[model samples]
Target: MTYSGDVTSGGAPAVRELDRLTITKVSVGPMDNNAYLLRCRDTGEQVLIDAANEAPRLVELVGDGGLAAVVTTHRHMDHWVALEEVVVKTGARPLVHADDADGLPIDAETLTDGDTVAVGGCSLEVIHLKGHTPGSIALLYRDPAGTPHLFTGDSLFPGGVGNTDQDPERFGQLIDDVEHKLFDRLPDETWFYPGHGKDSTLGAERPSVPQWRARGW
Candidate 1:
């Protein structure tokens, strides 16, 4: 089926097929957290974006391909509720930003800005985006045959940057990071998968950046 990026808790996942990789998105937890499984088309090597919630379902989602790693987007509790259990079952190495590594249940391999993570023959470039959490990150995969795809974690969504609890400093930091690190660097064709809810292209949300900053969300 076509990928719409629309999913509900306990519902079927939406799969996006790329030239070299396949992205499967699942919605989990009461918070409607989204977990993505990226599988290399050539090698079948897979990496999960977040454990989120529903350990059994996530394990089932992995199936026989086996997981290479689990990358936690940030240090928030909602994003890692099933992290430890998922890792225990899959034996996948847990990866996270260095600043948020100390907050996870198990020890995770720390990543920094510009670090490259391998997914079989494919690799993802890590983008460290601060404010949502000290180490919130986004993974970017530049598809050779097509456009770019990004896993933005909680740092970005369609409407605005991630929550900063109405703090001006935190909001400014997040918007700045998002604008320069993401918008300025990525092309408009970039399709982004957020931590929750629907997916959107950078071009679709580009016009509203100024409004989001003005509203101070």
Candidate 2:
């Protein structure tokens, strides 16, 4: 599905409202990493994904409601360059999978597969997918009146799965998790937001699973 929204000033990115959730996608840092702000319309409770960079802009997005949590998809420097600043400014706790919690800039709460994070009345289910990193994860939100939305940190993307280790075993694991845990289960209309670049849907990417597997990357 196409998302049309107003872009913010100073490279703040555009805001897309899906049902009760308002998502703002911003590209930041030298790597051009994507940071997303998810807000619950009814309660104004918000959750940030990545906190990749540009602390000032992120703080501006956080505003007065502050953030309920900042979820780090994996233990990657590019994804958390502004984590400390954003967390400090918003007083929002940082969360990461237990396997990747250590070595983060600050203390973080642990999230396991199937764990649900509540943002006001919205619920985001966590799905841990191994490969790109031992603890990479994706969050799924099913809108009551609309299609389900998925926030895949660095796991699944539009063109293909996230880059993985050269090792065949690691690549296999990632593909397995994605195919079984994601593609096989979720509906075709599910909207997937990746860690970087444009968004896509399961319907759009489903046909390429075989191609992705054969390519082995």
Candidate 3:
């Protein structure tokens, strides 16, 4: 089930193999939201993160392997614009955190922190990171080779944390979760894929945690 060469489709770029897993990254819609297709190479079963936009293109990407589920990192409209269409086309179940489930346009299965979603032979552990939205969640995949990959939705980005309202409490929660659940526990090589822009490693962003807190964004 090894896929070589360029797996890029439409304008989306592929990240190729991260150990045994295959990750394809697609940027869609006006907001340039990032949609990811994570495939379990051993079984070909896959899950999509943030159906963002462009149903036709997304359906094409799903292909014959089919989709096991579609996960919405948060309830943001931009992240789920094509969710309905994609689900209709593939019959994939929708999953989102219980806290933000009410905001989604369609009915979804509630995912709590620590829940594990199986994609073929691989498993993605869910981590609820609050404050980006009450239900903002991140998925952690520990490669067999020991490197870890994190799908952080809009919560943790390359340069800073997700945008929060002016309320000090909300901002504090987001930083705390990121520090404890992510930076403190994960290794430096953990690769973080965000909902937009570029990917970054924990080591690259770790040194600036103090600065991020002082700025209060």
Candidate 4:
């Protein structure tokens, strides 16, 4: 599916298409993290990308059953602080990779790469990126409009890329995943919504891959 939109200051206004599914971004927290609410216009099925620090807005969006579940890109507090509230409000489970699943403020359904989640007539495929954290996974799916979307938590950014200085082996592993797994496998034009910063397409980010790799981050 082709998803197109006019570029804007906060990335592009989420593209609305004939398909019932729409992604509304709720910019939350001190760093202005992007929390996405994936909704099915027709069925009212929704999935929350990150709870971040905005419980009020997040809770308001969870009123519809379209908010099927919460999918966290990583275990960071900023990304998950409101998870419990959203879960309580929507009665939806929180999905996360098994590795970073521990010490979560709330218990969640442990997930791994390749798991498929269906909500509001949309199904998302899970991809294990494993760079930002051992269990870091990216969600991949094509909206009804046929636009390919990747919800990359803190893994890949517009120009800066994910921080790997936390752990040497982990950081090195993340670098490898970006070069071989994410950049190579996914379509170059795939739209990427990272944990922070403006959104960018895989094709748009390809030119910087070399620079990212050269940094040995």
Instruction: Work out the TM-score per prediction.
Output: 0.98, 0.94, 0.94, 0.88
- The digit string of per-residue lDDT tens for model 3 on 1-217 reads 4322222234646666866788888888688788989899999999999999998898898899999999999999999999999999999999999999999999999999999988899999999999999999999999988689899999999899998987688889999999999999999999888998778899999999999999998
Where in model 3 is the C-alpha error above 4 Å?
1-10
Which residue pairs collide in model 3, if any?
none
Task: Give a tens-digit lDDT track for model 4, residues 1-217.
Answer: 3543323333433444436667766567676787877876778778888888667677875654536789988888878888898788778889989998995798889888889887677788877778677788788877655568888889888885588776667777887877776788878768888886668899988998888777666
Q: Residues 1-217, candidate 2: write the lDDT tens digits.
A: 3464323324647778878888888877677778889999999999999988888888987888879999999998889989999988888989999988985888899999999988888999999999999999999999998999899988898889988867788899999999999999999999888887778899999999999999998
Runs off by more than 4 Å, candidate 1: none
- Model 2 lDDT on a 0 to 1 scale: 0.88
Candidate 4 residue runs with Cα over 4 Å from true position: 1-15
Please identify which of the two predictions, 1 or 2, would achieve the higher TM-score against the true structure.
1
Which prediction has more favorable lDDT, 2 or 4?
Answer: 2
Would you list the C-alpha lDDT of every candidate in the order shown?
0.95, 0.88, 0.90, 0.76
Once fitted onto the true fold, the runs of candidate 2 whose alpha carbons sit more than 4 angstroms away are 1-12
Best by TM-score: 1
TM-score of 2: 0.94
